[model samples]
Target: MNKFYTAQEVADKLKIKKTTVYELIKRGELSSSKIGKQLRVSEDQLSLYLNGAAKNSVSAQHHDYQPESSLLKRDYLLHSSGLIISGQASPALDLLLNQLPSTPGNLPVLQSHMNTYNGLYSLYFEKVHIACAAAAPEDVRSLVPGLSLTALLFCQYPMGFYVKKGNPRNIHDFPDLTRADIIFANREKGSSRRVLLDRTLKSSGISPESISGYRNELVSDYSTAAAVAGGQADVALGESYAVRSFPELTFLPLTQETLYLIMHSENLDTPGFQAVTETISSENFRRTLALQTGYDTTHTGEIFSI
Candidate 1:
C-alpha cells in the first residue's frame, strides 16, 4: 500500500505554510488525489515534484536574468523548500544563516545578493522571505506601499573610502573625487553607496561627470575595493569590513550606516521565520558579530514598524 500525506502534512514536510502547499496544488505543480472529500498527495508524487523543482531552479540560475526574470526566479525559490534571503551581502547575515537551528523540515536558506532597493522590492512582492537592506528608513518606507512590513536592525557599520595602502592621492573627502587627477570606482545605480555618493557630491557642488571613472560601476563593496587595490581606480566607498579582506587597501571612515532586515508582517508568526529571529537573538550569533570587524551588533534583532 502507498502512503498519502494531507496538505498540512505536506506543509510540515516542506517547511512551508499550508496555504503555500494549497497554492502548489492549485497551480497543478503538485498532483493530489481526492478521497471522501479530502485531498491527499501520494509520496511518489511529492518526490517527483521536488525533483522537477530542483531541476528548474538549477536551470534558472544560469540564465541571464533581467529584473522581471529575476522576480520569477525568486518566486520559484520562495515556493520551494528553501528560505530565500535577498539583499546586500553581509558576513553577519551569512553567519546567522549558518547557525540557525534545524527545524522540522530543515529548509535551507538561499542567499541572493542584491542592492538595497532591489531587496526591498523582492520583499514587497513576496518574492523573498527576508530582505537585508542598508538604505535610510524613509527610503525603505517608500518602496512597499501596500504591504505591511516589519524591519529589524541587523547591524551598524562604518562606510568609508577604500584607498591604496599608502593613500598616494591623499583623497580625504567626498569632493576630492571631483579632482581631475582622481579616478573613482563607483557602485552601480540603485545601490546605497551610489545613492550616498551622488547626494554627497550634489551637496558639495561637485558634478559627477567632472570625476574620472564616475561611471565605472562595480557590483559589491569587495569588488569596488578590488578596483582600487588592483590599481584600476583611486578610491571607492564601501564598508570597513571589506578592508579586512584586501590588505593592500586602507580605509578612511566616512559615515556609519545601519543595516536592517525587512519581512512581511504575516511571516513573523511562521515557524521558520520565528527560528530565524531566534537565531538572530542567540548569544552565539551575538558573539560572532562582536568578533567581526566594523560591525556593531548592539541593536541586532530589535524590530520596528515602518
Candidate 2:
C-alpha cells in the first residue's frame, strides 16, 4: 500500500491540531508533499519525526549546551554519534572503521549488547543511527510498517557450539548438549541465534528443559563465550565472531547465518549512511572480512528488503 498521511491524520496521531501540523510542515520540521493542493506525509516519516523529536529534546536538555547545528542539521550528517554493534559482529565494524577516513577526523564507535529485536527498537527510538543484526527474513517482514530499510552484506557466519578448551567432553553436535554432564550456556530470547536454536530443538523432538543448564541465560554471545572460558559452562551457542574473540575455546560449525546492516530508510542517503554502505561493499572491506577468523565473506553486502 502507498504510505501517505494527510495533515489531519498527523495531527490526530500526535494529539495536536491540524494548524500545528501545518506550522511544522511550513518550518520544514516535517516532510510533506503537495498532492493537488493538499499536503501529505509518509507514515514512516511521521513516526521518525515523532521519535526523533522526543529523543533530540531529551538529549538537548541533558547536554545543557545545545548547539545551533542540532536544530538545523536534522536532514544532514552534521552530528556524529557512536555506532552500536549488537552481539559482536566485529569483522563488519572493523571494515567500517578502516574504510572511514581518519585524516578527516576520528569518529566514535562503541559496541553494546543489542540483539536483533532490541537493535530495531533502538532505531525506532532514535537512540542509534546504525546497528548490526542477525535477523531472519521472516522477522523483518513483521516489523511496524511505514519504516524504510537498507541492508548491507555483513558476513556469512556459522552458528555452532562453543566448547570448553581442548574439547574435553568431545561435544560434537546439538544433540550432544542433551548429555547429563554437558553444561549449556543459552542466549536470551530475541536473539536470532536463540530463535534458530529453539526451532532446531523443537523439530528434533527435544524439549528445552531436556537440555542441561537451560535455566541460566547470557545477555550476549560474548557473555556466553566468557561463561565457557571461565569454566562456568561447557558449551555456548553463538556466531563465528564469538569464537574468534576467545581463541582458547573450540568452535563447532553448525549452520550459516547472514548478518545484515540495519538503518532507517530516511537516513539512507545521508553521508554517514552512504559511507557505511560503500565501506561494506568495497574490495578492501571484503578482504578484511575474509581475513577475520571464522567469517565467510561470500554474501557480504547482499540486500534482503522486507
Instruction: Give the best candidate by TM-score.
Output: 1
Steric clashes per prediction: 0, 2
lDDT, model 1 = 0.77
Q: What TM-score does candidate 2 reach?
A: 0.65
How far off is model 1, as Cα RMSD?
11.3
All candidates' TM-scores? 0.74, 0.65
Residue runs of model 2 more than 4 Å from their true location after superposition:
1-89, 102-113, 245-248
Model 2: residue 166 alpha-carbon error in angstroms: 5.5
lDDT of 1 at 18: 99
- Give the range of the ten consecutive residues with the poorest summed lDDT in model 2: 76-85
Clashing pairs in 1: none
